[model samples]
Target chain A: MRMNLKGQKKIINIETSQYPNWKICLINELKNLNSNNVEIDCNDIDLSCTDILELISIADQYNCKIISFCSRSIKTIVSSQSLGYKSQFIIKKPSDNTLKMNEKNITFSKSHFHQGTLRSGEYLDSPGDLLILGDVNPGAKVSAEGNIIIWGRLLGIAHAGSKGNSQARISALHLRPVQLRIAKKVARGPKEKPQLGIAEQARIDSDEIIISPLDAT
Target chain B: MATDTRVILICSGKGGVGKTTLTANLGISLARQGLSTAVLDADFGLRNLDLLLGLENRIVYTAQEVLEEECRLDQALVKHKKESNLSLLPAGNPRMLDWLKPDDMKRIVDMLKEQFDYVLIDCPAGVEDGFKNAMAASQEAIVVTNPEVSAVRDADRVIGLLNTNAIKPVQLVLNRVRPRMMANQEMLSIADVTDILALPLLGLVLEDEQVIVSTNRGEPLTLNSVNSPAAKCYLNIAKRLQGEDIPLINPAEESSGFGAKFRRLMQTKIF
Candidate 1:
C-alpha cells in the first residue's frame, strides 16, 4: 500500500487488522490532519508490547510514524512491565539517550499534595498533570508540560503547558503565585489575594487568563 | 590537634541578593574577629568573588585548575594583603562547570577546613548542579535574601532544599534592606522573612552605596572604618557568626536624629 502527498499534507497507509479497535479513531485523526489519499493494507502483523522497540526501528527505517496507540493496549503494556513481566527485548540503537521514544504519554488528570512545602529556589518540572502536596513558597517554581494541579497553597511561580499548549490548565487549592505562565502567556499575582475555599483552575480562553472555581466544570 | 573543619555555604536563590558581597565582607569580618577565614567562589559560571574582594589579578590558580589537576589546592588559595588571616579560593574560567563533582567538592572543602578556621562557600543562583555540589560538603548553610518579596521567596526555597538535603542550622542574612520600606509596608520586614523561612537571622545589612564603591575598588566593606553603616553592620554580623552575643542593631533608629542632633548641639555650644 502507498500514500500520496498533497501539498503540505502527507497521506500514509494505515494497517487496521493489527489494531481493529482503534481503526476509527486513527482514521479520524488522520482525516483531521487533512490526509485524503490513504491506502489500507491489512497485514497480520502482531505489534505487542515486547515488539514496540522493533516496531520503532522498523518505522524509522521505513519512514513511518505511529502517533497514538490504543489506550487499553498501552495500559496493559505499562502494567505488565511494571508488574515485572518478561517479554521479548529489542536492543535500541545508541544515538542520543535523551531523544528515545516513550510509549506511555500519561495525562495527569488530577493531583494532590499532602504535607511537604516547596521552598524558595526549588523547581518542579512535570510532563503531565501535577498536584503538589504542600505549600509552594516564594522563589520556588513549578512547570508542567500539561495541566498543573496544586493540592496545597501555591505562592510560587507555576507554568502550565510549558511546551506551548494553550489548552493546558492550572488548578490549585490556594492560588497565590508571583507569576503564572500558561503556554506563551503569563499572569502575575500580588495585586490582590484570591479568595480561598474551593479549588480554582486558571486557563486561557481566547487570550485571557480566566480563573474560575474548580467546580465550574 | 586536628579539629573538625566547618564548611559554611552562603547561598541565595535570587541573583543580585548579595551572596558574593556577603561572602567577601563576612570573610574579612571573621578574620578581624580572630577567625582564620577562606572564601570559596562556587559560582563557576560567573566568578565574581575575586573582583568583589579586589583580588581578581591576584588569582593565579583557581578551583577549576585544582579540579583539573593543573594546580595543587594550596597553590590555588590566594591570601589577602589587607587581611593576612583571610584567603580566597577563586573560581576558574566561566565555562568550567563540569570540573567540580560532588566528591571533588567534598575533598576541596575538607582540605580548606584543615587550613582555614572558616570556609564560606559562595553558591551561585539557581538550584542547579552547581548549588547541589556546593551544599554537598557544607556543614552549615547561610541563605542571603533582601527584604523584598521575591528575595524572601527564593530564600525560602533554598532553606527548604537545605532541609531536604539534611543540612542543618541554615542561617539567614538579610542584605540591602531599606528600613523605611519595611516601615511603610512596602517591603517584607526582617521578621516576616524569618517567619517565612523559619530560620535564625544571621544579620541585616542596610542599603549603602559605599558597599558598591568598596566592591568596585576590590576591598571588603568591613575594611572601611569611615562610618559606613553597611560596613558596621557587616562587622556585627561577623561577630554574631562567631557565636558572639552581639545585640541586633536597628539601622533605621541608629541612623536617625538622636546622635546627629547631639553632635550638632555640642558643635554649636563649643563654637
Candidate 2:
C-alpha cells in the first residue's frame, strides 16, 4: 500500500490465505520485501504465540518496522500484549488506513543514582550499578550488585558486586572507608589517615580487595 | 526548658555515651529549679533510669501498668527522695518489650506532659525499636556524646535522624570531656564537637570519678553532692537551659593553664 500522503513512504501489507502452510509462504515473502513500514493483517489468520515471536524477530532482523498488527482474533491480541508490545500491536480499521506509531526509545539502565549524604546507620542498596552524589558517613552502608561510584567522601562501609561479581569496583573521590568489600573480599581502612586530594578505587585483585589511587589504573 | 511542657528524648547513636546519666542529672537539676519533671525509662529491657535516680526500690508500678490501664499514671510515678518536683515513670517489665508499641509510649508521655513541665525520656542505645518507640513521643531531642571520635560520629548520625524526623536544632550535651586532653589537643573540644554534630551547645560535662561513684550509690550526683565538679556542671547546664545568661564553667585546671588565661582574656563563653 502506498502512503500517498507522504510522497516517499510505502507500506507493505501482508494478508494471510486460508492455507495450512501459510506461515512459511509469509516468511519467504517478507524475506525479500524491503519496506520501512509493514502491516500484518490477522483478520482471519490463526496467529500462534511462536509465530508472533518469530515474526517480531524477523522484522527486527530485516530492519523493517511493524507499524501495526491488525488483528480481530482474541488470541492474537492477548499474545501480542504478553510479548511486551501492548500499544504497538493493535487492530487497524479497514475504513481508515492511517497508522499510529510511537517511535519513542525504550531504555533500561542497570545502574541507579542517589543524591545526598547517607548518615550513620542508614543504608542504600541497588540491584545494579549505583552512583552516589554525596558522602556516606560512618556506620552508613551502600551495596550494589555492580560497581559503586561515590562523588564525595566515603567514610562508611560499601559493598560492591553483592551478587558475587568480583570484577565490580568501588570508586570514590575520598576513599577513606571504614570497610570496603567487592564480592567475597573485604578490606578495612588503614589505621593512619588516608591522604587527601587523591581519588581512590577499591576492587578485587587476585582474590584480595586492594585500595589504590585511581590514577594507578 | 522552653517553659511549655515538652517531651525530650535523651539519646545517643552509640551505647555507653551516658544517655541515662544525663537524663537523670538533668531531670534532677530541672526539678531543683522548680520545674515539675518526669523522667521516663524508655530503655525497655535494660532499664537503668530508676537505679540511677535511686528510685528503683520505690517504683511500685512500671510503664506497662500505665499502658495497660492496670494502674493509674500517678500510681506508677516514683517521686524523688529529696526533690519534691521530680518523679520517674520507670520501664516496668522486660517481658513487655516486644509488646510495647510506639503509640503506647506516646499515650503515656502525653499523660505525663499534662502534669509535668518537662518530660525527659531516657532513650535506648541503638536506633532500634525502643529508640523509635521513645522518639515517637518526643517533641525535642538532647543528643549526648563523649569527647571522642566514635561517640561524635554516632552523635552526628543521631542528629541526622533527628533532622529527618523533623526534630529541628537538637541540643548537644558533651559528656566525659577531659579538659586536660582537650587542652593538649588529644581530645575533641566543645567547638570541635559542636562543629561536627552541627548542634547547639547545651552543656559540657567533665569526666569526674565522682560520677561513677555516685552511679554505684544509686544516686543522681546533682542532688547527692551538689558540689562535685560534675554536680556543679549539671546545675550550670540547667540554668543555661532555662534561657539564663550563664557562662560556661571551666571544670579543668583553673588555677594554672591556657583555660584560665582564656577565661580571663575573653569573658565570653567558651561553648
DockQ of each: 0.45, 0.38
Whole-model Cα lDDT per candidate? 0.74, 0.79
lDDT by residue (A21-55, candidate 1, tens digit) is 43453444354444332322222223455554544
Question: Can you give the lDDT of residue A164 in candidate 2?
Answer: 96
The regions of model 2 sitting more than 4 angstroms off are A5-110, A161-169, A182-186, A201-217, B1-4, B13-15, B93-99, B148-169, B183-201, B216-219, B239-271
- CAPRI tier of model 1: acceptable
State the weakest 10-residue window (summed lDDT) of model 1 chain B.
B262-271
Reference contact recovery of candidate 2: 0.62
* Model 1 chain A: ten consecutive residues of lowest lDDT: A36-45
Tell me the lDDT of candidate 2. 0.79
Instruction: Mark the regions of model 1 whose C-alpha exceeds 4 Å error after superposition.
Output: A1-113, A120-134, A139-217, B67-70, B95-97, B251-271
